[model samples]
Target: MKGYFQKKKMIEEIDKRIIRELQGDIPLEKSPFAVIAGRIGISEEELLKRAKSYLDKGYMRKFGAILLHREAGFKANGMGVWDVPAGDVQRVGEIMASFSEVSHCYERPSFADWPYNLFTMIHSESEDGCHEIAERISRATGIKRYKLLFSTKEFKKTSMEYF
Candidate 1:
């Protein structure tokens, strides 16, 4: 029940601070790293090196935006869960991720009620597009059982500040 990123190398206090600073809007400046480095009491080169090292050592996933789907012209942010067999999870995940609309894909533990082990996010321009993605994924993976949980209400959305 643990995660993969627990054992990371060269992750220090400064690196944690750097991650915290990047959680929100990146400062608008000539040298973002330089500004961030100054605030975190580290050299820009050191900050950049640690960040790159984290990526190289698989400590951090791709760092980017937490976009507002509706504002970004994506009318639906559907959570597509699939009952991909254990042996086929990797291939099926890759196939799902290959779709133009799928934003993310990963494996998760399955429950009795929720037999889905593979999960993916499909942000589409419309509900029809999301359905199309679901249909294509079903055909591609040959897994007939899956569910598309679309967001009916904007309840809570925010970025987690990793400090």
Candidate 2:
């Protein structure tokens, strides 16, 4: 599917390099952009302008930190899948997204064995906390049929690096 921007050609080589560099850890300093600009052989003003332009043009979403949920005391990362009625998928998704506990929520195609169309990622301190959140979601959305799949093991968890 095409992205919101759908303007890949608008991104120049320098922008691609800047994006690649951003994929790594941004400096923890008063002037992080200056540090990045220095490394990329560009003026800080130009870097700031380009970054702002990216956001303005929908080339970039939001720039923010990716917290380590486990380290942050969120021990359980539950995938809550709901068998929401076909006509109410969008409404259910919006309701799910309104919950602070739900970091990600969207609609997905259902399979023969699996009947869930709406899914949410719930992070909490324990399995019980996850279940409580799920229950609350059920009460809010009026979707009784749901499943909470807690992660047994997280092989790898990191933000996608786009170069």
Residue-level lDDT of model 1, residues 1-163, one tens digit each, is 4444444344566666777876657677788889888888888898888878778866677666667767888877789989988999888888888887787899999988989999899878888888888998899889999999988887877767675
- What's the CA RMSD for each of the models? 2.8, 1.6
TM-scores for candidates 1 onward, in order: 0.80, 0.92
lDDT of 2 by residue, 8-94 (tens): 456578988888877788899999999999999999999889888877876777777878777889899899999988898888899
Off by over 4 Å in 2: 4-8
Error of 2 at 21 (Å): 1.3
**Cα lDDT of model 2 overall?**
0.88
Candidate 1: 10-residue stretch with minimal lDDT: 1-10
Consecutive 10-residue window with the lowest summed lDDT within model 2: 2-11
Residue 36 of model 1: what lDDT? 83
